[model samples]
Target: MPKSLIASAEWSLLLSRLRALAPEAFDSQGRVLNLVAREWGNPGHGKPYLSPVDGSQLGLLPMIDLSTATHAVASAAAEAEEWARVDLDTRKARVSACLDLLHENHELLALLLTWEIGKPVPQSRVSVERCISGVKWYVENIESMMEGREPLGLISNIASWNYPMSVLMHAALVQALAGNAVIAKSPTDGGLLSLTLAMAFARRCGLPMSLVSGSGGKLSEALVRDPHIACLSFVGGKVNGRDIAASLYDRKKRYMLEMEGVNAYGIWRFSDWNQLAKQLKKGFEYGKQRCTAYPRFVVERGLVPRFLEMYLPMLTSLKVGHPLLGETRAAEPPSVDFGPLINSGKVEELHAMMSEAEAKGAIPLYKGRLEPNLFLPNQDVSAYLGPCAFLHVPRNCRLYHNEPFGPVDSIVVVDTEEELVTEMNVSNGALVASLACDEPETARRIASELRAFKVGINTTRSRGDREESFGGIGQSWQGCFVGGAYLVQAVTEGPPGERLFGNFPDYTLLPEKR
Candidate 1:
């Protein structure tokens, strides 16, 4: 049985805070306010968000057409130009104060995340807190980052909703601190209300940051093709990133794209079973929806038994349920490990992939129980999937090549060092990979062959900490990278139009590391 750490009294107070969340994707001077709902004798002109928690309707957020988006971007560009003229000191103060505002409102934002996307309360709070704190570190250090650089005009960031505050708002805040006005499209799936409040608070603090909510199909072309956007920072799937990359290819606009890939963990000569056991649960946190999740594992044949010994028990120990509910009541103590995926569609997709892998050659290692009892009897449980794992998933299976983007795990068995690296790199390239080998020479040799941006020799890595650079290799990333000083330079330039990254013959970027 799972426990809910939230007391009944606290849950009621949290609900009260969530009810106070009004949608507002604000621009400076409220320029885009009139565009939210045109009121052409119709109130049903937008999409209504369905709560992943209970399949209930949250509220209708109006969708705008391409023309409205164009107007919004142009208005933002004008604001950016004006905002750029403000003294650097004032910009820093306002932006830092904006971080302060978000910190104060994190509880409300966390609740909105739980209600909107079904993220567990603990992880949601951590995302909000980590993002605000990390971005604040950048604000205090931006002057040095901008020492020899000049601000680019308008920065348009289109990001996914998984880590709305940490990734989306994090980039936007740093862009503002760099003297660029930031504009964003609120992710279609979730974070609409949380990011709306973030943008509104930014506007109140005199930062030129704005966000729009609508269908990506309707707004993506305009958001990418618009003339006023000086740079684009995107966080989403590879297909959408490719589309935006195509639009920017001939135009010479700067961008930083963080896309998804099947990050893998390679296990070779290793005997630290207890320590390795401790890391398994953390790797599966948030149902492995994270872009950096190591969902694929390549294990040496000798270590297969040892690996399952740790992984199987870790799977059983994981608890999944409604974010706010316990086994008995809302007030019952202890929280779940995670909640549902973004939607039922994700659950279906994961199940389909798992089936495909099984049909090819994979053997089921573990399949935990789903606790749909935590949900309302009348509510849908399609979004809930328990921890699942497969052994010896063949190279021909779809799960062997692509990221399931859910809690499902695929492990490939290999006999030799060469086969281990081959299985690890079978996905061609990725953002992160991990290696667990007791021998330092084997670890060093294996690490050199893996095609990933960040390699954890004996652990896992993620887009945490302000000092670390975050970007991917191969299809996982496009355009220049973002993080630390590289992030600020994604928009600014040492000299106007000076190139910051080298490109392959086809123009895919080779991110510069200093």
Candidate 2:
């Protein structure tokens, strides 16, 4: 395929050019994956089909060559380390240059993102803009974070598939600009997006190939164990993340991981019913698949009956079919609210969990059928699933405790704010929580008591924003933030450069005399 190009000397001009290009769903030679849209939404014929608006999948996305990714990581790292040795201004300039390139090619990058996954065109555009914003944010703040630190000289970047281009781009580009060599891994599901990003950086930013690498199975283990691999950063599920953390601990590696969340929302004690209804609808519209998505509702006991009475009609109105066919309003089709689970395994897992919940005596007020969803044709396609809302017996049930990680949500009634806080805190994970309070005192109280990393007082908390410092606390994550200013500091720089004078032969003697 012919290489796509981005040429610019000014950041503004470059960004403008990028904004002007049409969406490039395929490569110049028409070799990249193709997408098919139906009346329901965009369908997939790719290796990893993720919706750009939401990270939900349309089909399996392709994986990049692990060797190729590794090579790129290694090369980028070397380039970054060399850049770091240069004067700070020069390093920043180089970093700025890469950012300029990224801005200049935003359209290509966004389209590459869309095709690699299944992001809507508009959302894909936002991802690119967000990445640019992230780079600038880091550029403005990274220097102070690196001062007075012992030269650790290593950065480990483990990225996920959800926002493949944006996540890895931040880690790789900023670290390189800050003068640290990066050893990186791309998620197994979103390989093409990562590879396209790798190519873009190499072609436009002049990144070396060695700085980025990927491995599957034991290869990931080996990469993690590589002694030169320094600061490790990971994004994935809780189980695999913990296992990876254990391995890092065994190797005594300095690392961070973004994992899972049993995220929750506290329906306001006295919320405006109409506005609350709208917000809750928007929450479920997010497909309830994000790590930070509102997965459970803790309605004040005084309000549960009324809230249920008021909310079910709205819930029943959701159209849970495909996301692309402009199904903006209304519920999904008769059977499914959204598309199928990313894979059959996920479907089975969700069913197993639901069955376990049922066996535990949690009566499902609303049951969603996986078999029907899978078998039902949506927008005339073979693979869409509708959304389902279920009400359970108790909030303390295992289903409520564990993350559904899908569009499914449940309700739990708490009598007091204290109980709500206690329940949210007691959970082993802590990604985010949404408190839907209207009064200032109530919002403040909930915000103060909430134990999650990201708190949403009046809105659904989101994990995908680049400007936000996103990552979970507790089991949800093992690190600090992932984007905005924090990501730059996390990789390229550390605390203020520390100065220590060691004993020197003749020089030490003269200094003592002075």
Candidate 3:
């Protein structure tokens, strides 16, 4: 058989299995996309999910309209106090059973997640596994977090497309574990099927975790302003975050807003370029779509050559193609380094950002080309851009301030010590920042100077696990946090404070409940 034919066969087989993960998305005869899932299921609206690699319609999802979404929120709010009254031990047991269901269907969910989001296979699998593990950690350790707290009605989690399961949905599950009724808005671009399946599993296990899906503009007002919604969690770009924050300003609501920032890594008087290079290579695992992705690099004037020499090759060598394609296919296919953006429109946006930066002074280190796709060879590879990186991005450039949420960003070379910190902190607030300094005293100094949520010295950090807290400082974050106890507190009612979690720098100083 030809390679394309083989790939087609594999694609069909895998897609069938993926569809099995969420039977709600299909009809008995496989015609309707009836996908509104709550206590009772109904068909709302059909939206076709386009493939990121080729712009092909992967499947049509039955999404909820505004009325459906409002009802879901109202229902969750009305039932939350009763849910809180349930014995904590019983709640844990129910959630544990749901996690077991998630575990059993892990491979199924992971397969669909990559197809929906354009993440590589290995990376998507790890995301699903880690989501399960992280939620388990919260469930086991949440008793201490509820000390002086009460369940804060309904927590509406609305986040970006990239980390629907691992971050946004992870926080939603933890909210339920913290005794709040949870409702999550599925990312309209991707992850609809996987999230709906996970929520369906939770609902089946007796958890009041409802899910709604639609465009943000249509539902943002309803979800944010709904009287029943006690807290709102918005995670996406800065514009959306700001709009939601503004809406909740006068309202007595618990909220967490995590927006984008220039997550920069500074190189100042560092010797180990090779080690730094490897870490940088691994850092762009998911096309830099992650909230914690270090898309900007601030290198010392003297170290620019060494940094580029070590970093450029890794950036340019990234492979972009269909997630199902590989040299050999077996139990687990050989993973590609880079995959599709959410869709073709995003690819065009990335091009525009690169063009703007280039016109302003940035140099294109690489212009990525798409590889031949065996999986969907006939379809145009519009969403797949191989590996594109830029250097000499001016401080005033839009690319410097706005994060290009794809596999592209720029490097800025700075001369003076003050200039290094100045350029790194130019975004004012960022999710994460790191400085590469082998020397201890200088590393500590540089790390302290960073105005980011998480700072790393000679290493890279991320939205960490159970013990570590995750929140942005300054403009990057605006509300309470997620991760361990902080996440629990954010969803539950409590007194105002400068510190909620352990002394984590990126902790969002939540506003007082009026």
lDDT of 1 by residue, 44-106 (tens): 246767777767676666567787778778888888878778888998899888888888888
Colliding residue pairs in candidate 1: 3-334
Screening candidate 3 with a backbone cut-off below 3 angstroms (N, C-alpha, C), the clashing residue pairs are none
What TM-score goes with each of the models?
0.91, 0.72, 0.91
Better of 1 and 2 by TM-score: 1
Cα lDDT of model 2 by residue, 97-120, tens digit: 767777776766665554344344
| Residue 110 alpha-carbon offset, candidate 1, angstroms | 1.3
Q: Which residues of candidate 1, in runs, are more than 4 Å off? A: 1-44, 326-330, 372-379, 496-514
lDDT for each candidate structure: 0.76, 0.55, 0.76
Runs off by more than 4 Å, candidate 2: 1-80, 140-152, 208-216, 250-252, 323-341, 367-383, 393-398, 463-468, 482-485, 492-514
TM-score of 1: 0.91
Badly placed stretches (over 4 Å) of model 3 are 1-37, 327-334, 373-376, 495-514
